[model samples]
Target: MKTKDALYNYCLRLADSNMIHGQRLAEWCSRGPFLEEDIALSNMSLDMIGQAEMLYEYASTQSEAEHSADDLAFRRSEREYFNCLLVEQENGDFAQTMMKVFLYSAFAKQLYESLLNSNNETLSGFAAKAIKEVKYHLRHSSEWLIRFGNGTDESKRRVQQAVTNLWRFTQDMFEMNDADAALVDNGISFTTEALSAKWQLNVNEIFTAANINIPETNNTITGGYNGIHTEHLGVMLCEMQYLQRAYPDAKW
Candidate 1:
């Protein structure tokens, strides 16, 4: 891929990851396990949506036609989204949600750190702004993970199961392709391979602090970066795309 194509793909991947995860988190709106958690989840959802808007807006500029950020977010098919499989997984329970958030925030924190030095000025600026928000996100999720992991027997058991179930999907977050390679070579994007080590170290420390044991399972699932997704993504995209598809050109 050319430099521009690589940059466009990189931006879209970032946008899709945030958009999908934000949509998932928004499902918790008014449905959180508690009042305070409800507010926190909604705030995180808003933050992720804001990040998606910034990323997709940049992606739109790289496209031939004038595509709006909403268009890029809600009008795309599941096969076209470049988010990792982990973000699109269904929110099973409070424990499961926390697990997902913990994993994603850890990765995002590292990703934004590297992106701060991107050769692409817009990407670098966006990363500089987003890293601050991601820092809070990481702290919040890590605290929740620690609480649940060491809270009560039931809480610990449920969160442990959630971590086990979600672990397979974690591999896809660091899965790099030719686009990533191109961007990394040109300094337009950071290599996720380099970030993965730090991400794992951070996660491991959090797990230890939480009194949770890392699963010894070696079954790693992949394929979302190439547009292949689990069954859940279709349902997510259907609900998310309904308004835009039902009434084309509709705007709030």
Candidate 2:
């Protein structure tokens, strides 16, 4: 029973991460720097939304409540969300947005790689399916990272500032809690410590080539796993849930 509860929480965390990320990316729909870049970000948003739906669908089957995907998504309160701080962060500038994307895609790619071998078939399958899209996400973000970092003086300055500002949130990506412990012990999930190391290596490789400065501070922000988030999340949720909250069960 404890394991079951842990699994449910784990699933919710994964679902929340993807859903919030997609929600944030959707904000870039028409706001991208260029028409082509705009469409690319939109496509990435759809991929994340689809991945969230798949995870939520599986999560819906796990508990007695039998919650639907939409319920787990639109109906959940801010305190119920388990997304990491990085994705829920406000989209600051185009450089900031791309920095967050690169950071998250690196983490997600490593995480999904670990999940591929999980004993839980639902999780493994979801990882397998989402990983391909994550690869594209990484490629796109990394490309931007290079261009922005190695471009003009202003572009380099902005991307560097974005990295420094967002660095604190990176630690949240490797956090582990009771649910994570249970999942690890049960062979349903692995320790994020290992994934974090690989992620750092990948980041270093790219940053070296792109001339992007890695932040020096080791300080980190946390608590999103515990349903505590930045003020930005509340505003984002209000926008995201307004329709569903105002018109419950009004699906076409």
Off by over 4 Å in 1: none
lDDT of 1 by residue, 199-218 (tens): 99999999999988878988
How much lDDT does each candidate structure score? 0.90, 0.92
Which ten residues in a row are the worst by lDDT in model 1?
A: 185-194
Candidate 2 has what TM-score?
0.98
Question: What's model 1's overall lDDT?
Answer: 0.90
The CA lDDT at 187 in model 1 is 85
Q: For model 2, what is the C-alpha lDDT against the true structure?
A: 0.92
Per-residue lDDT, model 1, residue 171, is 87
Taking every candidate in turn, the Cα RMSD to the unseen true structure, in Å, is: 1.0, 1.0
